[model samples]
Target: MRSGGLMGTAALALLAAPAWAQSASSGDGDSFLGGEWQPVDPAELEQMRGGFEMPSGLNVSFGIERAVYVNGDLVANTVLNIPDIAAITPEQAAQVADFNRGRVVQIGEGNVVMPAQMAGALVVQNTLDNQTITTLTRIDVAVDSVATLQAINFSNLISDALAGSVSP
Candidate 1:
């Protein structure tokens, strides 16, 4: 009633062979996976710099320039500009719009504080007792976004935040 071990082992070995073979150091033309270890050339990677082909799925391009898009969830992002919430800065808006035009660079991080945090800090709390130990930590990125219409005065923002001039 329970004899599927060989199939499981074979499947696992097949999946793991690529990773194990890649790292095996063999000078005698031998591999731990019973195959020759082949080195991947850097030029090959460069040659396939653009989009990759999937056996099945959508065909996309490695487009990194401004373009008019349709029916796509496009978000404008940058490292040099921040949106002015008080009022939209024409220049910053244009930069974000232009940056989105490229349509290749994807924004991985979002949810920025009003004034970006200069120092990446984590808040941690730890408590211990004879019976139990409790630890809590929160990680957050405190950095400004790239697309700022104008320059930011960090000192002023910090001073104002500290003085309760502005509520975070």
Candidate 2:
């Protein structure tokens, strides 16, 4: 009878464990890596004119959690994943890292930092010129003037900053 009771207690404990575990987890599964890597919709697909085309075999297990636009063009996209970051290549990892380091998008008067995992494949459009700048780059991260720099980071990155705050 003791053994049966112990088994019953164990079963009850197992059932209760998941409830607590779910609270700590991003149960929404909205991540930029390994989550869902689906392709851009037909309406959104028209924007990728001068960048690496989304691979045909690109697997997307989850929907995009966020979409970023610049100059009315789709610039950055993010999702979630369940697997390890190692699933992507080192070069890809580097690109992702580069994309994320200082990715700050200047929308209107505000500076928004893009998430790291979705950094590599950002597609930003210049609000002024309406140009679709493919790829977030280190150069792009640089603020234009001292005022913009002041708006984002007041570091001395202005004179030595890259062309943009994004990396491919």
Candidate 3:
């Protein structure tokens, strides 16, 4: 048979296959494939945060204040401190702002998962090599109700995993 005919036959065979044969199934009649969801412990969460490493020459620092399971979702509050925002070049500042502007930021070195954004807050959830880190930036506002600075929240999942991977 010609290559085109062979391809068509294969496609027909796949189309004819029953749905049950294509889907995941356990022998015990349960359709679900995985076990029940369990909350991650504090120690393990810390380990994940340790995995995240900021790029070198970024000239910024961050700290994870807290991590808690809210409605089965991990919520981490982090503070990213920019001591000398003026010291950083405009390009570097733009890079940081752009990092929070996307749903997923890929800097060619690592993946930054930003799921949502709101007034003065950026929600980051990153999972690399089976380690998951979710963070929520805690924003600080000035006396005039104007937002001034923002922090990057790191869960143990990111910090521990990225430990030694980032340099000052």
| The best candidate in terms of lDDT | 2
Candidate 2 lDDT (Cα, 0 to 1): 0.39
Relative to the unseen true structure, what is the C-alpha lDDT of residue 49 in candidate 3, on a scale of 0 to 100? 30
Per-residue lDDT tens digits for candidate 1, residues 17-115, read 556756675456666656654656845533322342323332222322222212253332222233222454676467555544332322224333322
TM-score of each: 0.16, 0.22, 0.19
* Pairwise lDDT winner, candidates 1 and 3: 3
Q: Rate the local accuracy (lDDT) of all candidates.
A: 0.36, 0.39, 0.38
Instruction: Name the candidate that leads on TM-score.
Output: 2
Model 1 segments more than 4 A misplaced: 1-80, 103-168
Kindly list the per-residue Cα lDDT of model 3 for residues 1-168, writing each as its tens digit: 376455445344444443544464434554454555344684554423312223432222332233333344664333333334446556546545654443332223455543453423444444335443444444321111111111122233355458747864
TM-score of 1: 0.16
Per-prediction tally of clashes: 11, 23, 26
- Per-residue lDDT, model 3, residue 47, is 29
lDDT of 1: 0.36
